[model samples]
Target chain A: MTLTINDFADLRSAEALEAALRAIGAERYHSNHPFHHLLHSGQLDKGQVQAWALNRWYYQSRIPMKDAAFMSRVVDPDLRREWSQRVVDHDGTREGVGGVTKWLRLCTGLGLDEAYVRSEQGILPATKFAVEAYVHYVRERSLLQAVASSLTELFSPTIIKDRVAGMLKHYDFVDEATLGYFQARITQAPRDSDFALAFVKQHARNEEERQQVCEALLFKCDVLWAQLDALHHAYVLEGGIPPGAFEPVREQGRVAA
Target chain B: MTLTINDFADLRSAEALEAALRAIGAERYHSNHPFHHLLHSGQLDKGQVQAWALNRWYYQSRIPMKDAAFMSRVVDPDLRREWSQRVVDHDGTREGVGGVTKWLRLCTGLGLDEAYVRSEQGILPATKFAVEAYVHYVRERSLLQAVASSLTELFSPTIIKDRVAGMLKHYDFVDEATLGYFQARITQAPRDSDFALAFVKQHARNEEERQQVCEALLFKCDVLWAQLDALHHAYVLEGGIPPGAFEPVREQGRVAA
Candidate 1:
């Protein structure tokens, strides 16, 4: 049951490679993580959900920056045109817009202060590390791998659908307006992922290049999954949150206003 | 109790501020983390230990780069003279003689391939993130806080004592020969941390600057702790190691020679 890059080369076509990559997503995506289960099932208390939103806002905010960084490295103007839309999508034309602005609304809906979330004063260190890892991955790796890694967008729609539905059904606080980010992503992610997939598939000519593409997707999956793991460890299992990260509800009032 | 930077402004002397900083170290440093306990107690298997060595090598390797970056920022000749030694200490006069070279030997001592370790081919994404965070930290933060963050070295000797003794006692494979890095650190860390502490206590004048210093040290602690957390999750708890990182002992023989 062990998978390696060597197994990727035998993939005869992009279809086969795409299927294997989706298989990896099904098996290992953050949706399968326990924290997501808690999130959807409404098992997490308000504070936990707040922590999730606040920590996740950091990730959401950085996406466009990373995408821009990735876009900056691409040589082709045509390709750059496709990738630039992502930055526009995440950072909308006006204030109180874009994915990041939407994510901040989710934090506000969860009862977190906008300033605290923006300050990143209350998010977990693990969240920062995980998110920054993705940024660094895109910046340092080959442009092909950078584009390929964003292929996690390939799987985001299903999770978003489940998440929006589950949050509506399970959590009282997260209403349609607060969860609007998912609505945009349902379309935006597929559009983005499709372009990226075709780009990677066409460009990766050799076995080594193909393997790098596959591995890039896998690396990104780890980045996302690792974010959840840190949340689970710090906020769930040990109940030992790092200093200056999100404070639990019972302890929130104690930290200075 | 939560600590604040304003309290330091009213301090009686530089020694008081230094004590407060050390006190922050006593409370918040990585020594309190469970992974450190697991590492020092030898509860980790050889593969877990190998993962530690492999990931930590990334941290070790970057110290010179960070030192160089830090040195590049210092304008004072006196400070530059003192800071430049750190880069020399890490890089050494010759290629195979410095801290990085010593760390490579530690990796090889733990059964890693020399070329693979030196190439940094298999390091965990989280490890790279943590180290990159450090380099970026030194690059972006106020010079005073950046110096204070290195104050973790002030606490390093004690952890080094525990790590060296416990690693040697419990792991039949470890020896003074393999862990010679810590022996050098025993003397060097104190000398380094002392200078850093002196620098921070003298330079951090205002409440905001003082708070920045405190936060920087905490940030550095998180950097160190997150590295261990990532290694633990990937190699031990979650059980999915990243591609190109250390293979478990069972798989090592199967990897290409």
Candidate 2:
């Protein structure tokens, strides 16, 4: 079902609006995807997990681009000031640090080559499409919608906790330092999503505006969900790999046809 | 593998560059995808066909937007003048005419709701991402690369002929009238692609520019191939439909889990 702006026609209060937005994450977030189930439950093999980390690095690398796109359109100094931190968080104050670098550490920790992950040649075509869509959505949509899209971060903390604990417990290759990206995001995401959620609630004052916010969150969920769907389809399911996507150097169990 | 500008270091002549671009198509085009084989070989059921038509309508509907984006970035009046015709062709001189309208007719002819198809809610997330990537590539890339991306049309005439002929021969529900979109494209695509090919060959004069052109065309082929990959993975291979994509009202063969 496609989400339309008219779906939240009756939502007027800020609390009600907040509830609607949270409801979208509850129902549509990538955490609900079966791939997440596989990842968090340690049901996937090392190569499959390698594929996950490798594909996810693309999304991680693009977060700053998405934020930059969002920031380029914002005129308010305060909003820009608040939002610029996200760019720093991902890109870092200098090279060899920040979230993207940390993600590279996780990828390398998984026994994948750093250059291969950075080149992003082996990632599924669907992963590229989905990540690019998020950047475009932020660039093209209304400020309310753009801010609301980041509300996916509002739900990320729980997933991060679950993921960190699950991966540490289940996977021998992943260690505390390797998962630094998620460890940082557990704090960073709440701080970012809190600001974004407050901004969305304050800005989206009417029914139509509220609906746009809800739909924006839904769209963001779709972005995240679609990425996992691609990963699961390509790496996990039988005979699911597309031509030209990343092939693991060592096939753990499921072999590419 | 990630296609880089360095990949075309040996190709200096337009003829060589053209061969390289066409080689990418021969190897990577959606015509080579399994979904197209199923589509053209009359292997899929009506509901599956409906899913194909409905999802494709999103792509068909976005052509004008993509063209308009390209035209918007063109400061050259002559270039814009030549390019604007594509928008006219897809959007039509009148409301009930044009390629998008004809695609709607094709959808309705395939038993899909016109409004629903137009809403584009049912398109796979991968489809949206791939199509939007094309538009974004045109908007952000050098104008030379933008024009080169349209080179997919160079290969479209053959695919359209095979599709129209195969669908007419195999499917009882479709007639030549309902398949007017492909018939129109049989003439229109070559004309558009010829102009685009000439523009790319003439503008991409040096080795670096030639490499960019090749990468651009390869990128466009990836865009097309990726969409089919999504459809095949979701609808044909393993019933791995992402949430909120079009669900066939009747399960023709592969049942959604």
Candidate 3:
């Protein structure tokens, strides 16, 4: 989020702002993170994959709360109405099906315990921090910035496709059924990002506003990237699991990369 | 911070509470973290050491703020006055020398840029979460729990001893002058924790209170431990530095570490 006033001269138009935001996703998004490559290419073992899903469940679990936080700050009934759909999308109807539910399915598919995933007991503290920071960012920052942070969805579809297809194709334990979360996201992310992208592009009236918009996206990218960084560092690089985090139960969970 | 009602039986007495807190420290303190092992024994490289100092500066920088937060909730002027010394210890007199200033000396001695360290631009996001979570913990938890969180200071004297001695002996870049921070801490931590420990012991009225006291210390241990986890994860384990974190400058910075 390092935008200075002098560095702010070029993003005065919505076209330029859109280009800048897309450029940020292209450059800084978590898709570019190595963990994603490891994940998408089936380079990770079952434990690493389980670690990814369990930790990611924390992020997925928090999405509705982040949206609820964003909605809490909205004074306009119209904005709040539009924002409530994100909550509905994540929390689902009274049927109790949502992104978190589907994510738990994925975790179960990876051989993670559903109750344990729901309990969030074993996730890394960094995951808590990064995800909680996202909630805080929405509650504390401007409405426009809150809207802009969700713009990462603009880039999620391709990653979702790669992730779903990659998991199914490579990992024998995972089937199309387990990747239901990504399937929902495939359509949902574009619709959500279309709305958020237009909001950011339309409301960022000047260079400073545009820069703040870009910073919000950058901040969101860091949030996603940092989670993987923690996972990779703890599980892959050194296995220095913090005290009280989940230890994976090994099974037919890994796919040969 | 994972203390439940059933895990509550053992910590019933003040003696038991004190023992529990210390045991938690013995088991969970950052001193037990391998990053500290690497750091204390001179197994880390220059970049790792600089990364440690720089990232730690963020925590050191927040100490007075956390103390002031604890002080703010105090209604008893006597208690407030006793607590004010903590603020004074870190913030110092108008002479502007204190723990943070001393810590910057340590950082600068390790060849880190003083401004960059102060800017906190390169520290891990987990460091922010862990540290900010400390501040939030002080503000949001019960006053007794807030004081109990400082109980990690109970174990700090020895780590300070080991850190000072080990760094000086192992790392050529460090000397006594650079480690003024720990020298102050060597006295300050025990005094502060003595007051806090006494407060926790005297005031924890029941098994539930004692359990919470233990939980606070455990949470503080997590706070400290999580920062090192991030440092180890980013600098030592994988060098997978998160985007925008500090990159160390090479000089006569590393010993065998």
Candidate 3 lDDT tens digits, A1-257 = 53322344699699999988877787778898889898888898888899998899988888998888888888999989988988888878866588778888988888876666776767887788778778888888999899999999999988888888888777888888888878888888898999999898889899889989988887888889878888887788874777767666522232211
Model-by-model DockQ, in order: 0.33, 0.41, 0.43
Ranking according to lDDT, highest score first: 2, 3, 1
> Quality of candidate 3's docking, in CAPRI categories?
acceptable
The local lDDT score (0 to 100) that residue A27 gets in candidate 2 is 73
After superposing candidate 3 on the true structure, give the runs of residues whose Cα lies further than 4 Å from its correct spot: A1-9, A250-257, B1-9, B250-257
lDDT of 1 by residue, B5-113 (tens): 3344544456666677787787778887778899999899887887788888889888888988887898988988898888877787887877777888887888877
Model 2: native contacts recovered, as a fraction = 0.49
Off by over 4 Å in 2: A1-6, A93-95, A238-240, A250-257, B1-7, B75-78, B250-257
| List of chain A TM-scores, every candidate | 0.94, 0.94, 0.93
Candidate 2 local lDDT, B1-257, one digit each (tens): 43344556778788888887877777777787778989998998887888888878888888889889998998889989999889989888989999999989998898777667777777888888988898889989999999999998988889998998899999998899999988788888999999988888888888888899988887888788878777776788773677777778733232332
Model 2: how far residue A50 lies from native, Å: 1.6
RMSD of 1: 3.5
1 or 2, which is superior by lDDT?
A: 2
Instruction: Please report the candidate that would top lDDT against the real structure.
Output: 2
- Alpha carbon lDDT of each predicted model: 0.79, 0.84, 0.82
Error of 3 at B78 (Å): 2.3
